[model samples]
Target: MADEITVTVVDDHPAMLVGIEQWYAAAPEPLRVAASGATSKTAWLPPGDAADVVVFDLQLAGQTTPAFGELRRLVDAGRNVIVYTMRDDEQTALTCLDLGAVTFLTKTEGADHLVSATLAAARDRPYTPPALAGALSANTSSDRPKLSIREEEVLVEWFQSESRDLVAQRLNLSPKTVTTYLDRVRLKYANAGRPARSKAALVARAIQDGLISVDDL
Candidate 1:
């Protein structure tokens, strides 16, 4: 059997810490909960005794934003980090990626998804949630046409609907207007080389941009 994976969880919430510990405790393979930290003040063990995966909350009580430097320290020392946070803002997500987090999972996600992300992180693979993955890929290019507030609104309403007519009614726009907005969205994506073909794809892109919540959809 492969060796048991070691994990460290860092979050201010005691319940969350215990919950995560319990999940690892019940895994089929030997899954060790190496350590838990509620704050950055705690001493992080060296790589030898350190965890293979670290699940951290991007925003702690005292921290307004994610401490990318601290996260970078762990990565540089050969540890992988999975950001488990409630903040689903697009800039925050992009910053976390730029700072080298292996994966970003929202607290709103189910426990199973968290466990899967944890395991994937242990394997040195990125575990971006499908909703967020679509979002991130959509915003890759700087040259993509900027979406106006009205256009964005139209796009959101369109994707959230089961039918184009429904979307048009909700947005107080005609079907032709909705179609025009969608066409523009498609052209923008195509020009940026990140075209989204379907409503699901569009939803994903919206999530990545932090325009919509994964739970909202």
Candidate 2:
């Protein structure tokens, strides 16, 4: 299907993999689990590389704790990853978002949230699941990206506007200048170790820094 959202699922549990595949198969929209594996190598190395979105389980079978290394590798490679795990805490969710995951979802969020998040990730669109929104709201850390006034203006306007052109028109600046400001904003976030590669990720960053609220969207 032309509009089909292709997914690469990576989970350690065989039963969980089966369940996820079933969820994708029965999704309301055109969705496909193009590939799945029990580990990073088996799941994302070959066939999974071409998938539109990667549904990843943070805690794999072998190692203890969440696998931030693998997650970092994927994000650094410019892959849109959704960290699906059983852990449902504000810190963990915030950590994943800061590391550049497209979004974070707990396994308990179920099929509806999972499918919606997958679709949003595949299309490079914004999606904030309830858990993530809660996390963003609960976050009180002082850590933030140090953006210039112009950069913040452009960033906030871009978030409110549908497109960069609209932002430029509203600000009375050239489209190229608007793009430059946004690029600088992303760079500042990246330099602060809070990568914002997607609009959704940037939105998450803005929320974390208290520059915007969930209601602002």
The candidate that wins on TM-score is 2
**Which candidate leads in lDDT?**
2
Q: Which lDDT tens digits does candidate 1 get at residues 161-193?
A: 525588788878897677566544543443343
Write one digit per residue (lDDT tens) for candidate 2, span 77-145: 778899999898889987887888877888877888799889868865445555665565455678755
Q: How many steric clashes between backbone atoms does each model show? A: 1, 0
Evaluated at residue 99, the lDDT of candidate 2 is: 86
TM agreement with the true structure for every prediction: 0.60, 0.69
Worst 10 residues of 2 by lDDT: 182-191
The lDDT, on a scale of 0 to 1, for candidate 2 is: 0.74
Candidate 1, residue 94: CA error in Å?
1.5
- Can you list the residue pairs that collide in candidate 2? none
